[model samples]
Target: MKKYLLLMTVVLAALSFTSCMEELGSYEYMDANEIKIDSIKGQSITQYDTLRIVPTITQSRNTSEENLEYLWYWYKSGAGENAKIDTLGFDRNLNYYVAAVPGLYSARLKITDKETGLFARKEFDISVEAENSGLLILSDLNGNANLSLLNFANIFSQDIYYAANGEYAGTNPVGIADIDNAGTDLHMIAILCADGRGGVVTEPTSFVKISDYSDLFYVMPQPIAPEAYCAVAVLYNTGMGITYDFIINNGKLHYRDFQYAAYEPLFNPEVSGDYSLAPYAILNNNTLLFYDNKNYCFNILKCSYGQLKETKLDPVPLPEGTDTETLAFDPRNVGLEMVYAAKGWKKMDNDAGYAYGIFRKPGSTDLTNMYCLRFNIGYNMSMGRDYFTPYFKHSISGATDLDKATAFAMSRQDPYLYYAYKNKIYSYDLEFDKGKVIYDTDTVVGPGARVDYLYFRPDNESFNMWAATSVEGSTEKTGSIHVLGLGRNGDIVKVDTVYRNVCGKVVGMTYKNR
Candidate 1:
């Protein structure tokens, strides 16, 4: 019985082998098209520059080039799953003009064989830089507001705001603020004007208007008065950093936390306060120190839990073992009104220390009696009411014409507070309690040129003073911007660069980072 079974199995195996051979011989085989992409070079170009890429491709089979479909596109590098893919072209080569903002990108070429349904792809890095980036001077030109750019290459481009927007930013432009981390979409430039037009937020790279000032609020105020705009970075307890953009309109604080949504109407109710704020304020890590002009005192806005809560600063306290007579002024209830206030040189671990403000008694017309008040809001808000401390209160010394000064700026590199008075620039050394003339615009720029604005680039570590000046009697392109190099002792070393007669009467300036 076993021998008979072996025979049957051999017979079945032989039949199955013959069947497989016959099936194999009946089938036909052909080579499929395989795509090969050659190495493509990386690209580096400025915004608005043409980005051209010609790729070399080959196929393994004898397929016609017409049978292939091509796609060229780019997206922000490292965007991962949320990357926004922008189509560059749908051709074999790329010749796309880059209108994208300044950033790192990844350009890709994808070739697909339409017949074989096979694909090949190649990717290369691309760096897009701003074509016009540097100091942006917002000036009042011929009764209108204009924006000018002094580029990194030392070339000046005037009326950039008008060129891009086809209209003036607004008449009587008072200030410009760069929202470096406005949102994930892009940086923003807030152009503020006092001409009842409020302000406009524009794209940082192109100066293209994004929205009108009224559009930035959930419920617009009755009379729009945009005074200042600033974005401050605050670190939370969860180890996350959030940037909140603060807008001061008619002495009210309006803020938006970009982490929640992009450009949503700033949180409503404006900080729940009845006090009118001064036009100037200082921002520490998670706290905003604002002086209430109505109450003649200071208010603290502590940023936490994605909401701004008012923190009551304890009364100014004398340090342990210090003389009670050494106290200068009460920070919580300062009796004077602020004229100009700026962040000082002293910095704590997580906060700005010793902010200086020039103040005078309310309803007093005597500017010469103005006093310099220095104080610090403690670095740690967890300390509760103990955060407010007064440092110095004294009359400004060794400087003349305090009443005639138009602008004031403080140097973070040193204890020098600079003020622009007519045609001269004076520096008051806060540490030494002395003041002296730093630069004379009349002698340097021209005979009738007067300093109209004084600012130090907030990001620059060195003391490169920026002064905006104009002729006393003219408003038509009479503005000039100078970058003055400063010595360690707070003296002007030389005039490094100057843009003469570039825009209108300069009122405000801010640096635009690339």
Candidate 2:
């Protein structure tokens, strides 16, 4: 059996996983006697089986003279009041349950503030489907409100993705990401949805926009039609091939209409068909850089904003069977030069510590004249980290090895690459080819700062980039953003703490110029 491992978020700092905290919402103002009824909130029930309806209630009496009270109203559409839930718990929680044939139902909330005289009443309705599908919720992140489904006792795992609009385009979404393009308010995102029958979760819409989304979108549509999307690779009727539907303005979703044709890759014998992994980056409105699946080759697709030109090919000769995924491109490299962490010891067929290597895209094809940054494969995982003792000079001698990094962000005045280790942030000056490690000072970051997400702000000076660190591990994702120091040249410069917002599992990070 093949063990499953997530490539994006690499080896994690292990920690205890806690049940997600009660993520709830509350009202702003309330009074004991004011004529106000808090909107009925926190109503959860199962499908046709066992139903647990727990609605929060609060009531108060002014001056601390009177006590709080609680009441629950449970009734059918036409029934008066035969079954009423008036029970309270030690923590003043109301737990009421009902079991009925799948249909419409109503529940009420009664709140009485204990210290002061205040009371309110509210009611809401819920319809339990024939069979409970899954619990769904919406989160507005980067203009995209994704539908996150939980508690489904079914398959091994599922991946889900959202259209630029609110529609869930791809299948079950296991992971989603967006990397900014040129001037458009857009980026590429993929949904790792599960394939109905098993092993591989077909990566559909290897890229999708987040701005164009909708609430009318359903994960499972009736009559069964493969949702029109961009596919990394599809097993069509004839055979398996690459497929992508250029999105026109989806009517159901009010989005911008793209003046382009939907794409259907007609197999060409002239070219060695390779479109397995779609990793393309649009540098601007004109230049497009992409890597085919297997990471064996890279292509630069040049085109006008309206028409895509012929793909320029280049062979990235790896150490025999060594495969690569996460690659970073540097815009300031003399030519189209970039770096990617390769696998080391796995290349037992090769030399010592020849695990991962950083190959530069010096010129187009022919990997003859290439430079290897690090001949070790240890940095292959998406979140893997290795620290160098304070004595390594050849590797850190003026920040030379810093070029073999995964994170790269560029701006008008400042452009830099980052190698996020366990306790410190290393910065390599792109112009000088030398790097420096930044330490947390009394005023800057903590002694051992762990960065999760990082980006460069185009408008800030002195501090060009910002770092967001997880407070603990992926679960207790306590993290904050700090400023970058540009004062010292060769020494480790400390950063300053500026913003803080603890995240949950700090999944992925993308910096939009906006």
Candidate 3:
């Protein structure tokens, strides 16, 4: 009885299936609109270039153009799920000015058939390249800040900050730092000023303002005063390495580590200390030396786990076999105020490099009696006191009109120190303890023209000096930027080029790499 009932159930199911198939075949069927997009391809363009794309569309049901809606948008590639999507246009075509940061992105075109409520999308890759790469000059135009660019082709773009942002960078420009290779996503140009507005950071490629100086700190200081910026490489014992960007503001030091994922601020808290710091700092691999103006001493900071720790410097012990006198002053407690400091050449096998600092006795009005202190830097303090011990201290001899100098720069390949006084640039060889005038604006730029700034390209293997000079006229000051080459013996070998009357009282300069 059970087998018979099962057979009957199977027969009934087959009959019902046949009836349903016949009923469905008796009804009419309509094809839905199928949209297809083509003719769009990946693109490679430079920043600020016009990105135009016209995608060809086809529909199986021949849908009317009026019934189709178009949308175009893009987002940075690899910025998963929460990526920032920017709308381009609502038309079938796309015309966008590529103002995005230099990087890879994905652009998409979406077409929707309003009648059928069906949509189709096509995505393609885009690579945006930096439009400008060369030297960026930050100058004080009257009282406002002006940023200019000198490209590899020798073309000059003036007031690029205003051209891109429709406003000045800030007032009282102090310095500019190109922070490349600081981290995976930390490439930027920092324009520092002493104005209450602090300063600004911009996209290295587009010159678009990223944020103000206060936005970079976790807790913004009441009054902002930015003085200097630098980036240093930090190597670990496990063969790992990273670069960190440092900024000195309000006589304090702050650092940024962008590697680890966290909600922490872009810059860490100010390095805790009671002393007022100088505007200048010397950075090397894993270490930084800051001069405390209030205490008249040098403070050492070592990098560990993305944080800076104040380290103590051991006293220098004189070598037994040599007649070299003991260091006249202790680095930790020099009784003089810091006038200037600069990084010198590094030995081939040493992780640390030589550095020089100019100092004068407290409350001393005579600059002619200033002294130079030499020391090593950039090594791990855990390697022992011998790694970065002070080398020597001596008077800055043979530098004429040292009291009148306005700017100074040190050579990284030799013991050549360059300083500008009035209209002359002199190079003092620390090795020979002598000085000579290498560039005289009385003959080159003009008589009575004053040297406003001096800098050496940090990346250049050879000495390439950048000097900014200005001559005061009855109406205004005319500024010129000269790129001069230095020979092996620390003398001006040739004038590479000169941009005359290009800016106003050039104060700071930095190189923007490609």
lDDT of 3: 0.76
Q: Per-residue lDDT for 467-514 in model 1, tens only?
A: 899987785788888899888787999899887888878888887755
lDDT of 3 by residue, 319-393 (tens): 445333455566657878888888887644444678888788787756567887888774554223434467777
Q: Write the per-residue lDDT of candidate 2 for residues 1-514, one digit (tens) a residue.
A: 1233553223332221222222223335654354345435543444434444444333233433235555655443333456444332322345444445333456565656555545566677644432323322222232222333222222111223333234543333223322222122223433322333111111212323332222113222222221222222211211222212221111011111122424212212122233432322212222222334334344443334334434333332233343232223221121324343222222222111232223444443333333333222222111112211111112224543243333334322332445554445666543345556654422354553455444543212234455555444333323444555554342335544354433322223322111
Would you list the C-alpha lDDT of every candidate in the order shown?
Answer: 0.76, 0.34, 0.76
Each candidate: RMSD: 10.0, 27.5, 13.1
Candidate 1 accuracy as TM-score: 0.71
Pairs that clash in candidate 3: none
TM-scores of all models?
0.71, 0.35, 0.69
Once fitted onto the true fold, the runs of candidate 2 whose alpha carbons sit more than 4 angstroms away are 1-272, 275-282, 292-297, 302-305, 309-415, 441-449, 457-463, 471-474, 485-497, 511-514
